[model samples]
Target: MSKNLSALSFRKGVEKNVFERMVDAADKAGTAEKNDIVHQMGQDHLFGDAITLGAVSFYDFLKKENEGKKVFLCNGSACLCAGTQDKLHHTLESHFKKEEIGHICCLGRCHEGGAFQYQGKNYSGQSDAAVADLVKTGKGDSEDRYAVVSHLQPAILTAEFPGIDAYYEPFKKLIANGDRDALGADLKDSGLRGRGGAGFPLHFKWASCRAASGPVKYIVCNADEGDPGAYIDKYLMEKQPHSVLLGMMVAGWYAGAETGILYIRAEYPDSITIVNEAIEDLRSAGLLGNDILGTGFNFMLKTIKGAGAYICGEETALLASIEGQRPEVRTRPPFPTIEGLFRKPTIVNNVETLANIRAILTLGGKGYAKIGTPQSTGPKLVSLDSWFVKPGIYEVAMGTPLQTIIDLAGGFKTKVKALQIGGPLGGIVPMSHVGKLTMDFESFKYGGFMKGHAGIVSIPESMPMIEYIQHLFQFTADESCGKCFPCRLGSTRGKELIAKARTDSGFKIDRELITDLLDTMEQTSLCALGGGVPLPIKNALQHFGEELKGYFAD
Candidate 1:
């Protein structure tokens, strides 16, 4: 968050909700959509989730009651492309009557790395100095205005973006105070769906866990945002640790979960530190572990780091990883709800999904539901990235038109040949049909994509589309757990076929060989990875037949 412009225009939905006292979104992130993007510009880790949430709670805590305080709330997920940060400072100072404390920078690129201090401690996988800071030590000197908050994460904060303001604050208080009906009703009314890929209805999951016949029910924040190009979970854990803790606490209270576990990647060093600190903070404040906010209901949480496998992102595999086993995926005959971790009835939600719980409890579910389309009723964190016109996190409404996002990104940097919907495993949307697309689950199916992690990849003219597809296939092949036949062998075969098609001096282009390999992987792969792996390659080849002719000419 580094830019020194006079002011910045409202990004899309900001103007509409400006009047609302408590804004769910931060300066950079919009309505909460999980756009899968791995930021290469910033040397951050825990993947990316650590950045988003780290920025959130710090900002929320810094400027909650005192709107008169002009603090620069720079979200970690959004780095300064131009003058965005400076413009934000101007807006906060002029509009909110808050003291314009210096910018709360994240991503360490705050006006040419201005946010970092030589004395700062560099967390292994986190930005050098992304967390909020009020480092100016003084004896209550009123002249020192800038708080210097670091690493305000957008990932956790956006969970409540769907609801209006402190709609969640009240539910959080109620849950802390032991009001189950209010907690349940608010979460339900918030229409807060889980941010996990499964997208299960949050209220339904909570209710199911709450009503389970078992003596004990469990709530799990699937902090393993392991989808390729996703870091929202890590960001939340590191930045807004309490938001996630509070979410789990509220979920534990609502779903009757005696305990909860945050299954995150051990690789995310920043997340571990921040999460541990937040846990300690709440424990000291007596709002975590047990008797939160003086409620009779008791709850506890633990952070289990994952071994870092894509499939582990699947709830079953994640449960296995947390239990200290190999991170292999398990089937869904009895979904996590019935036979989850330790074969107990468990509810697993991604970090962004669970982040909404505290807010939903504070705000009525109805308020939350009003944020997005009827079907998808919550703000989502989309980690937007890659060779796009604009590269930043976008929080668009669930059903927002894809064109709006494309346009929002200032259009493609190069000629837009194909818009790859979803992630590497997701299919390609040829240049022809992208116009009709919308950014929700419903429209994703038409393009033969499932909106996995809301990953939108832009294909420029310079991209060797066929080679890119093959690269994805190769990555999938390498990552395969070797559990199932289709995924294990099929991905291998598919990658081979792509290689053959790309550079095989083979006298003949065995189209059937490639087609059959794709077919087998699609039909037999264990999870979406191996199964979905063949899609981009096959779809690209199918859609760009003319382009493939060059390779087959041998």
Candidate 2:
């Protein structure tokens, strides 16, 4: 392999503007390689990582941002749109404030790249910098767009402060509100599907759990994000953990759950410690467990270590593991709603699913529903990885085009051949189909894409198709629980077939045989891993068939 083949920087993709800016900056500095700069992004911007969902916000110190601007209350739970918009507002406030001008009427444009919203105005691509720059530099903020600065390093400046629990700075003056039920109503109206991969309607889940036939129900947060490229769940757990706690508490109250469990991946030690610490602090403060905020209802929460099996991500397997049994999946007929952990009805929501519940409880569902695509409401947070530019967990209103998602990631780092939509079991979207794609379950599933969990892994043109499939199959085969026949035996057989596909020997390989095996797995496998294990291999064989046709051409 050439030195370039091993180049991580070659995988560097970005928003064109961010790419140009970083490239120009790195060139002038001439101090480091591009990959080094890329890796250091989370540190530089104080974005801890993908799983933290949020990190320390410097907007607290920026003079312009804190001024008369209404605080949207940023946190990991609020995600990019909230964070990016706040930053844009801050930038505008900073720009306008630099001139020492008190012009609140029309503060130029939102320079940091968010659409500005007030009772009377709609400012897109307008920031305080735009207004201030117009006044001071006498020019409009010419920057066409903005992208999340991915090359920034993990920040410790805020963490260094005395005991910060939330990823953002500790805010006091607990803003008071009236009638929290109205807040829940607004969220229900917002049409916000849970940001969790299920895309299950948030309101329906809460209402169903509430109506479940039981005196004691449970609300479990599935934080075991074992996905290869997915790390958004860990982000909220470690950084803005309080948001998760608050969301869970709200979900418990709304769903009438008496107990809650956070099933975290035992592998994520950092997340475990952070979450535990926050829980301990909250307990001591009497903000949890019972009589929360003095609302007559009581709910208790506990954290359990997951066995790290992929199937454990399925709710039934999670409940079994929590019960101290081998982490194997159970059929979802009685479902969690009918027979769950300890045989009680349960509401199993994702970490991201519950993370935004607090906002809905406080803001109301209707207001929340206005954000995204029609079928899929609210902001969807996808963890962008590998081939995309500006890739990270981005929260946007539903129906945001797939191209827009890639654009947000800074476009392609390599020549785009296809995209793997939903992690291991996801669909491979072609370059031509990028524009036709929408970020929703129905649209994705109809296209043979499964939203298994919100993991977006891209495949570039230069990548070795065969090797990628081999690596992915190895993961599926190894992770199989071995309880069921098809998953266990089928995965083993699948791997063997793939190995044979790699070697021509003396005769033509049976393409039909391989396709038939894939079909059987899709139809009869026990779970998602078993079912979708054929995706990577099948896609590779179908698209790169010509390359394999010359297997004996040597």
For residues 293-411, write the lDDT of model 2, one tens digit per residue: 56566767777655335666777776654543344677657677776765577778787776665445434566555555667765555666544556556665457777777776778
For model 1 the local lDDT of residue 447 reads 61
Candidates in order, TM-scores: namely 0.67, 0.65
Which window of ten consecutive residues has the lowest lDDT sum in model 1?
Answer: 1-10
Q: Candidate 1: how many backbone clashes?
A: 67
- State which candidate has the highest TM-score: 1
lDDT of 1 by residue, 354-449 (tens): 666654554457866766688777666555444455544566667777777766666655576876555566667787877777767667766665
How much does candidate 2 score in TM-score?
A: 0.65
- For candidate 1, what is the lDDT? 0.54
* TM-score: model 1 vs. ground truth: 0.67
Task: Count steric clashes of candidate 2.
Answer: 50
lDDT of each: 0.54, 0.55
